[model samples]
Target: MSNTPRTLFDKVWDAHVVRQIEDGPSILFIDRHFIHEVTSPVAFLGLQQRGIGVMFPDRTFATADHNTPTINQHLPVQDPFSANQLKALETNSSKYGISHWGLGNPKNGIVHVVGPENGITLPGMTIVCGDSHTSTHGAFGAIAFGIGTSEVEMVLASQCIMQPKAKKMRIAVDGKIGKGVTPKDVILYIIAKISASGATGYFVEYAGSVFENMSMEGRMTVCNMSIEMGARGGMIAPDETTFNYINGREKAPKGADWDKALAYWKTLKTDEGASFDVELKYDAADIEPMITYGTNPGMGMGISNKIPVAEALGGGQASFEKSLQYMGFQKEDSLIGKKVDYVFIGSCTNGRIEDFRAFASIVKGRKKADNVTAWIVPGSHIVEQQIKEEGILDILTEAGFQLRQPGCSACLAMNDDKIPAGKYAVSTSNRNFEGRQGPGSRTLLASPLVAAAAAVTGVVTDPRDLM
Candidate 1:
């Protein structure tokens, strides 16, 4: 190890540092490859056409989540498109000799969810996924990024991916988090304050007191939204939280290997005097659970704040105004009392064991609102089983939440599950773009607690109040 102080990113980058070209990005050595139903099909076909195969097949893992149905995993998928895609992923992975964790497999779930659950994501590694939220894996101190279909083919054919170096930004959130606040709120607040484009062209590194203290799930939530904040990727340096989380995973190095890995992982931290291209800071206690009042992720406010006026919206004012008109919302209107058509509490962003526990805590013993339709999907099949084993399902069902099959249900309109046209849905998904949930369906992004609170009350209520 070099005596130079290294950030977690520096450690991982140096470990995977293959070769550097003069004035060009270093050739990165990818450690793990994650596959989902949506992006693997084309990449597989590309490989077939080239007569190539997955170079490091075991390093690649496949799961159908984005388009997999949250209901009836036992039965055939309800949507024809989804059914075909899931089937194709299974076939493609099988043909290529890659491990595909299909629905019903103990490890199957969202690509992002399964990677960490099974210890596939670890410190000092490079990870990539086809989904933009692939940044979620960076919480383990890995350099994780989302890739295009073509690039997926490149990685499958050769474990190395060509990439340009991204400018770096360190977003420091220091201080204690306020009650009723969460990492979800922290990211939402970051996006709101910085606006959606604040980190554009940069790889964001989350830092400071609040981030350092965040749980693995919270760190995942922070990194998950890196893309939304206009960064190519987001990362948090690994600490004891990261090490403990990876200790017992199926793919984690074991025994002597684990000891060896830990020695290396301990070095994955920012040096005290290292300089970054950009630096940002925020007070952790100031953040609160936020809700989107307009079409984009940035058009959000604390659950207590009213919708923004056009003047306060900056360059996106016209777009924000248009989205409000589309969603039938008006400026100065409060979001809490809006009638909700659906409440969705799972996504790559919040569909984890911790997120479910939090949601269940909020809704336990409460009856689901008669007027609200709710779906609670886990991030992965392992998460689903954990929920059942922990009796989380019973608590959820009694409280009027159904435990849906593991998949990216309602987060995107790719699967059969979708909010009907013009209906309002409070979702835990990351994006709030127009037609994100479905054509003309309005989405208000919030944390699982907020979504659960909305489900029981038939309106958006702050969970902090109920808790």
Candidate 2:
């Protein structure tokens, strides 16, 4: 080992380098590779065409989510393309001896959600998936990021990826967060301050009291959106909280293995004198429940704040005005009291058990507004079970909301749960880009509490008011 102090990212990345080519990308060994219906099908086809098999089928896991219908999962898929992808995923996983979790399986769910709950994600591991939110696994102190289809195939064949290392960035938040603020709100506040491309070509490590005190689920929510700010991925140093969340979970180390794993995990932290390429800090008190008014995640502000005029925002004034026009809003317009046509509370980002509890807290005694269409989908079968076990389903039912099966629904327009054209939706999912939810659909990305508030009130409202 070198005498120089190293960051958490350095410790993990250095350990995984298989070969460093002169003046080119290093070949880094991958610890875990997760694939889904949409991204894995093509990679598998490429594998067959090349007459090569997976190098480590045990390290790769497959699940059906991106293209599966959130409702009527038991029935045959209506879309021919989606059905073919799902079938291909099952067939390929079986042929290659990889673990497969298809719809109707108790373990089936979104690829990201199922990975952590089942203990497939662990500290100090290098994980990758075809989906951008693969960064979610980094909450465990792992080096995780999204890869392209060709790279996915490369990993399946060789268990290695060629990549130039990303620059390291550290974002720290201190002070106490106010009521109604959530992990989602904190990240939105960060992205808005830095702009969407601020962290381009960097890997972020979250530090300070705020992230240290956040729950594993909350930490996952924050890391999951790191890509929205142009980060390669985001991670937090593992601690007792991370250990506790993994203990006793299926596929996690146990007995002598548990002790050995825990000892190694304790070392997955930044050294005292380590430095990053860039560093930034924020006060938690400055963040509140946030919502995106324009087409991007960075185009956001506190729920109670008015949209800033174009000149004050600085940058592309024409693009800013165009974003507002796309959303049917004007400069200086307030987000509060804006009518919402739909509310969705599930995705790899905020579709955890804690998110549902937050939603239920706001809708406990209230009923859904007659004009607001609500889609309360869980992230996985495990999360769905948790909702029913914790009585969150009952609260949603009493509020005139129906729970949908687990899947990556409405976060994108890939499945049947798309937002209608010209409709306004308060969503807990990450991203609010133009037509992200559906063609011509207007999206306001907010926390689960904000979505619940809109579900009941039929308009944008501050979640703190209800709390």
Candidate 3:
């Protein structure tokens, strides 16, 4: 091995390069390729059109998510397009000899959630999916990112992808985060500090005490939203927390294989003297439970803060005004006490057990506000089962909230779960882009605690106050 120091991103990416084309993109071998109903059909159809089979079917995993209804999943799908896509995914996966978890399968859930829970996602791997949140897997110290339909077809055909390497950035946060703050808050704060496009053209490595001490689920939450800030992806160096989370999972290595894997994983960290193209740091004490006041994730501020005036914005004035108008708000407005029509507590970003626990903590004793329509969703069936086992379901039921089955419910408008037009929702999902949850539906991205607080109070209340 070379004696030069390397960052974790460099180490993992360098190990995966199949060939570095001179002055062009590198061809990198992919360790995991996750596909869903929305983006895989065209890629598979392309393969059929070309009369080619999947190069390494074992490396690709398929699950019906984007189009599957969260409720009554066992019943036939109602939408023709969604049904067709679901059918196509199953048929294609079967024909390609790829492992598939379709609706009603006990193992089924969002592609990102199922991968890590089943040990299919590992440290130092190169992972890709057609969805942007594929960065969620980067929580394992892997080099993971989203790909387009064409790139998906390419990977399916060769188990390799061609891509230019992204610049490296290290974002380190030191000190203990305040109470009621979460990994979601930390990421939102980071995105607000650096605008939505701040980390564009870079793959980030989160370091320092904050990420190191975060749970694997928390790390996944942080990494899941990396793309929202315009990053190629974001990773956290694997450590004992990662190992323990992966150990004994359904497909994790066992016995001697576990020993070997653990040994390798332990080495998946940045060397002391490694350098990054850009570096930034934050103090954890400054972060608070956060919420997005405008359309984009970067429009976030502390829960207690007011929306900035147009003059204060300095740039993007027109876009900022448009975002606020879309959300039915004005500059200098305080989001606190604003009426919320809906609340969502699940997605690949914050649908883990811990997020549910946080939501439950805030709602355990409080009843749901009569004006709020709340959707409690789990990331996967496994997480749904976890909610039931941990009594979260009971707490939710008592609080007048219903637990929807998994499969990316309310994160997007693809499935039956959608926020009505002209309504405001406080969501735990990653993005708050206009109509992201549904057409003309204003979304306020926040942590589960914040969502829960809003759910119970029917307003954008501070989770800290509830806590």
Candidate 4:
């Protein structure tokens, strides 16, 4: 082996490799496996067909998110199909003795959100889920990413997966971020700069002052979008911030165990002089409140800037034109005064308590625009409780907004929260792909602050203007 220093990704990856196949993928061990309703059913079926028991049930966690309705969750799931999926998850979890936080469980919420809150996510571990936003766990310095149904089954049966190593990348953002900028803006800006495929074939580690100073929630928001940039996953080195976030979590280690874990966690950082296959840096000040104007996350611009002229787009003119057409926009159109029909302020990307606080902050003294329908869904039941306990719900209610129950509402068109056809929505979700929120629906991905601004103004207004 070479005597080179190792990046955080390198160190974590190396420690998790069970065995190296000759000229092939390594047998990588998974320390934690998270499952959700949308993808776990097939994997669990495969296990039943193979008559295999889960190798280590304690290491696996299951939750129902994607298909669960945001409201009326207290009653039976109204949609039969969604109910079936949730039932399947519960059945499989029970059959396999895996810990499950089903709908209405106090612990139930988005898998990504629940994992960190419960401390199921930890530093120096390998974490995987069937959802692409599994990168959210990487914010705690774990090597986390999404997997396919087959890979999920493999992990369930064997606690390991065959994986080729990914190249390492470092994205460093320095300097002070300006007021009104949130972590969602930081990621949207990065995707816009690098394009959606910029980090293909790599695992990125976010460094520099901006990420270092970011809150755990903020770091999670940034890492949650790593897949949009085509990176396998993204991570940040564990620090005091990470420890503090994990310290008192429900599932976090206790007493002596905590001390032992803390010592190891402290060591989970990139070594000095380590090299990456690729490196990119940006000034945090250069990033502002951002919004996507096209069908892709990379098609974003600062709230103060006009949309790009078609001639300036990277993809072929035909596709670029098609995307703009889908969004009912023309090249060089300014989004500033564009009418917005809906505002969504919840997702795994921005559905935490922090996100709600940001939304409430913007709309505290303002009324929701009558023309704009706003859906404020939290990511989990815990977050919902926190919203009420913190009086954020009261602020939202006084602002003419209702707090919806927790679920992955409107982030995708999977359930009852879909946007109507041909309507425009400013969403805080990770994706802005055509029809992602609903058929014929147009989504503009943005931060919770930006979405809040749109909710109160009925237009794409700069959050800074409201501030």
Error of 4 at 316 (Å): 1.8
Top lDDT prediction, candidate number: 2
Model 4 steric clash total: 0
Task: Summarize candidate 2's per-residue lDDT along 343-446 as a digit string, tens digits.
Answer: 99999999999999999999999999999999999999999999999999999998899999999999996998889999999999998999999999999999
Residue-level lDDT for 122 in candidate 3: 94
Better model by lDDT, 1 or 4? 4
TM-score of 4: 0.99
Q: Which lDDT tens digits does candidate 4 get at residues 1-467?
A: 44778899999999999999999999999999999998999998898899888999999999999999888888998889988999999999999899989988999999999999999999999999998999999999999999999999999999999999999999999999998999999999999999899898999999999999999999999999999999999999999999999988989999999999999988888888999999999999899999999998889999888888766756778888899999999887889989999999999999999999999899999999999999999999999999999999899999899988888889996998989989999999999898999999999999999999999999999999989
What TM-score, over all chains together, does every model reach? 0.96, 0.99, 0.99, 0.99
Q: Given candidate 1, what's the lDDT at residue 308?
A: 78
- Candidates' lDDT values, in order? 0.86, 0.95, 0.93, 0.93
- Which stretches of model 3 miss by more than 4 angstroms? none
lDDT of 2: 0.95
Off by over 4 Å in 2: none
In model 1, the Cα lDDT at residue 252 comes to 95
Q: Could you give the candidate ranking by TM-score, starting with the highest?
A: 2, 3, 4, 1
